[model samples]
Target: MKSYDTIIIGAGMSGLAAGIRLAMFDKKVLILEKHTIAGGLNSFYARKGRKLDVGLHAMTNFAKKGERGKPLTKLLKQLRIPYSELALNEQHRSKVVFPNKELSFTNDLNIFTDEIISKFPHEKDGFMALLEDVRNFNEVSLENPYESAKERVSKFIDDECLREMIFCPLLIYGSAWEDDMDFSQFVIMFKSIFMEGFARPEGGVRRVITLLMKKYKELGGEIKFRSGVSEILTEDTKAKGVKLETGEVLLADKVLSSIGYPETVASIKEDLEVKPRVGKLSFTETILCYDKKPAELGIKDTIVFYNENDAYHYRKPKTLFDEKSAVVCLPNNFEIDDYSDGMIRLTFMANFDLWENLSEEEYKNEKNKVLEASKDIVRKLYPSIDMEPNFVDIFTPKTIKKFTSHHGGTVYGSIDKSRDGKTPVNGLYLIGTDQGFLGIVGAMLSGISMANLHCLMPAGAES
Candidate 1:
């Protein structure tokens, strides 16, 4: 019968963020994680001495050190992390290849704008106007199910190509529901990525996770690894604490579920349960270790969104891969001091049901098919790389399910955008991807924001 002011589930980005906030406020906080280590999605796995960064490619909402009012700066302030310690590397540029056209955006807005104007001279007005709309777009909290990304953008822009292009990067970064994303979700993604651009941590995502863990521990917050909540303890319509799989009960004034909404609700022992209407959208990524250098191949950019002339559905694919872009990323391309053998990650959206019903042999066959196709695509994208992978590992939806226990193996969690973490059950809150924030930075912000409102606010004051 251990008691604390708060019990946070999962030690992922959001969970760690919430724990750090609670500890900073001098609240007795404890975080329980099922895995032995933290950074659930944005974690790494060692294979043959090379640490593979599993989920994080790059952090969105990029801001330079000491740049006030920016998302990155804001996060650093809340967590009390020094900007010099982060040592972020700005990406030179990123590519977005469409069926008939392509675009490139750089860390410099002038260069990004010039590139767009140079290519599509006639569509210059439309593109510039759209940028203004994106900057002035404050409709992040609008709750209209009938409105979608396509609905809002189409009102101002007339070009079908440019319209789809506007959604290309955002959908690839934060898509949860359908090809046409929820309008509010789109605004947040646009602000985080396009408006803010991207930056890479010096030691990658693990560095950020390590910093949060350190801050939480320094603040006297406790974290229990290999501990999982089997059931949520509730009585008289209010959550009391959690019952661990070890038959131990830890009481708390409130609980923050960073795992997910539906998954948390179903774990409650009471008759209260809510099922998630998932989009069946998931992903398959292949990590390849080659024997060549990126600079040797004349590869100027670190990442390429290679669309083989297909409109990005950004949702559940009909087949393994349809007319969509292959997200090809060179994780080691950032400005790290050391250089090693090449590591390339190729990912694409897929349907969970497409492989969920496979037999053992069927699953093997399907996995091989995707691997081979992906290898061919990698070679085609970089013809002069002299590619020879010493290690090739592919992770499908089954892997996602095994790691996160999410329905449909969905990495984006649920599709609901209006959920504000407050559930029908009192004293329970939801955060992370399910709470409508996407990517590593978004998840951390979601956790910190929700905790400040629901957990730290005054008894009679507005949250």
Candidate 2:
């Protein structure tokens, strides 16, 4: 059996990041991925000669200067990956259309504030106060559980509509939770997305994964695809190795699981004394529609938020699709182009259990129903464009579970600011969306944080 100093389960960004760092330290590392690809959520698939990303609509924290100087750029520099900026049009920076009125959010805070003031002059003070809260929340620096963030925003912003418009969508993007989510978790995301501009890689998010994989391989790290780990071997209540699906056992000194919190815990065979609440949490399901490119659809590079009103309402379990939701547009480019046929991608929150119960046949029918409903929502936003899409792909919680091996197919492993993020399990480290923070940047940062902790500990130190 092959052996190494450490074995990382999952080849997603967090796992790859951990491998790159460990390999750099001259430690032998092996990454086991169940899927054929390496990027996890960052990876993409090809259909009819075109590539479609599973998720990853856009990114922030890639900016080189100003607010971008924090974590993301620092990691890229360490990894020796080079990136360039992609500009957004001033007119369509970000548009949010509610039932009663419309608001435009720009990269420039002053421009964005002025636009909001123009539309709702009566609520200018309230709007400015809300912006101040977001800015303050973004500026504060704290450790993993951001206790200050939760306190600050709740104390300052009392208007439900304003909070719903400004912070609710961010909550959706961050944790599949609404605005009422823990403020500290929301603050980490706010700093990443708002302080930094929305960005895409030169090729796409897949390129980010490819770059990391190349670096990992160059550092002599090993990766085995289609080799799923069925169980984690343990001795004396400590992790020792992993058992693969093929009945092959490999030993290692340490094991880091980026597959998400629940699945990772389930893989551990030992009946450990300490068990944290990692498996129970909610998730956001995404549906993607692709085609040659819709004609006469004047799209922008911006993400559009569609809702009836901006009110922060905490959604109960299994009630994800009940509320008024936002539809995000992910197009090739924002500008009107005739050179090539275009494709539009739409994503929204969905019910996990609802989709998991459907059979293959039932899934196809339910997928059609979701597509039709989504199409109607999109048509209402962009009425000028035609509604016939060439292809439709729906991903439920089960899909995420099957592909990523995350418990409950949760986009993130576990909800943040909860007991899970701080739960101490000997020899088992948890990172990625399940640890609380979401988004590409958040996942990478979490991995880096865990790596740093591991690096500081003494040999055989309990983590």
Please write out the lDDT profile of model 2 over residues 314-423, one tens digit for every residue: 34346434335655655555332221345555555556677677788987776666566677776777676565766556665666667776656666455432223332
Question: In candidate 1, which residue pairs get closer than 3 Å at backbone N, Cα or C atoms, i.e. clash?
Answer: none
The C-alpha lDDT values of all candidates are: 0.79, 0.63
Error of 1 at 243 (Å): 1.2
Q: What's the TM-score of every candidate structure?
A: 0.95, 0.86
Q: How well is each residue in 1-463 modelled by candidate 1, as lDDT tens digits?
A: 7999999999999999989999999999999998888988778788788767787678888887777777778888999999877778877677777767777876667776777678777778877777787777664342435357788788767777767776887888887777778776777787776667777887777788888989999999999998989888899769999999999999999999987777887788777646666646688988888787676677767667777655666667888544256787776667662436777788878768777878989888888887787778777777787657888888888888777777788888877543567776788888787877778988898889878878899965533
lDDT of 1 at 311: 60
Flag regions of model 2 displaced more than 4 Å.
65-68, 84-92, 120-151, 176-179, 273-297, 309-323, 334-340, 416-424, 456-463
Local error of candidate 2 at residue 153 (angstroms): 2.1
Model 2 clashing residue pairs (backbone): 293-342, 301-334, 412-434, 413-433, 413-434, 414-434
RMSD of each: 2.0, 3.8
What is the TM-score (0 to 1) of candidate 1?
Answer: 0.95
Error of 1 at 432 (Å): 1.0
Q: Give candidate 1's whole-model lDDT.
A: 0.79
